[model samples]
Target: MRGALGVFIVRPNPDAGWSLSDADNGEVLVFESGGQAERLAMALARQAHATHGAGEVWVYDRLDRIVGRWRVAAVGMALADVDETAKAA
Candidate 1:
């Protein structure tokens, strides 16, 4: 919500299976389970360029259910192309 970044909401299901929502772009839907939150968060980071922004990921789990969310750094990094030197800089 602060800036442009990928978002994913994971929900568990018994019949249809886990639900993956790409709230940021809303252009894709992937069905998966087991560590779904981690997967989605990684995907979001890849798309949102988290490594560049020093972006960190947080996972929300309740009752053994995973719901992933992406958080981008407001300052520090700008989500640009990440490099070792850049990170060190």
Candidate 2:
């Protein structure tokens, strides 16, 4: 697990159904159906050039427990930052 990972704050949206914030790049991902969250995550992973073995998207709860992981290629800067954050923490 690397890059930016946080427990997204979610709320109901009038236009959409649900909205997740504090995601990658401070963007909000809206989902119409239940599985759209995963779809949005997959798209984010693809954009981040993630494939497998190197880095992944970890969705966590408020307790910092991982709920899911989306595998992708290693992102260098992102990984380094994550490492630094981990060391600091």
lDDT of each: 0.46, 0.47
Clashing pairs in model 1?
A: none
- The TM-score of predicted model 2 comes to 0.42
* Top candidate when judged by lDDT against the true structure: 2
Taking the tens digit of each residue's C-alpha lDDT, what string does model 2 give over 1-89? 22354323334466646555544357776777536665555555555554333333444344443444545544332322344433533
TM-score on alpha carbons, each prediction = 0.40, 0.42
Ten residues in a row with the worst lDDT in model 2? 76-85
The TM-score between candidate 1 and the true structure equals 0.40
RMSD of each: 10.2, 7.9
